[model samples]
Target: LAKTTQPISMDSYEGQEVNITCSHNNIATNDYITWYQQFPSQGPRFIIQGYKTKVTNEVASLFIPADRKSSTLSLPRVSLSDTAVYYCLVVKQAGTALIFGKGTTLSVSS
Candidate 1:
């Protein structure tokens, strides 16, 4: 599995757009970049994923550059409820248990 590096923390206000970038220089061709958010005392939940270019879903958007060395998870108009620890993971196979790095703690204030 590829190692992931992300910020230790971030701050944002309600209604602001938050972008967290993760770096995975050893990412393999078959690897997919996936982002998950975990609230305190809860399991991490999938937010978005992308192999290349961009992928968007109801909760968030994943942007992967051509090199696939780094990616960004974008949260739009974030609210206090969005405050959580966000994880960036490199997944190469399905049904594999999620491997987590020290996540980026996002603080959203009103």
Candidate 2:
């Protein structure tokens, strides 16, 4: 599995756009970059995913560079309800349990 590094915390006002970048210097070719968002008590929900280039959904957009060493997740018009922890993970097709470390906590204020 590939290791990812992200910020510990971020602050943003309500109705603002937020972008969180994660670094994965040793990503494997079969690895896919996946982003998850978690609220206080709930388990993390899938946000977006991509192997390379860009991928976008209703919730967020994932951008990956050619080297595949890093990716950026962009959230548009974030609100207070969006305040949560965001995690970046690299997973291969093989079945394996995800080991989550401390994620980036997004604090949305008014």
The number of the candidate with the highest lDDT is 1
Q: What is the lDDT of candidate 2?
A: 0.92
Write down the lDDT that model 1 would get.
Answer: 0.94
lDDT per residue as tens, model 1, 7-27: 999999999999999999999
Cα error, residue 7 of model 2, in Å, equals 0.3
TM-score of each: 0.96, 0.95
Relative to the unseen true structure, what is the C-alpha lDDT of residue 26 in candidate 1, on a scale of 0 to 100? 98
RMSD of 1: 0.9
Best-fitting candidate, measured by TM-score?
1
Query: Per-residue lDDT for 1-110 in model 2, tens only?
Result: 88999999999999898999999999998999988999988989988889999999989999999999999999999999999999999888673877576889999999
Clashing pairs in 2: none
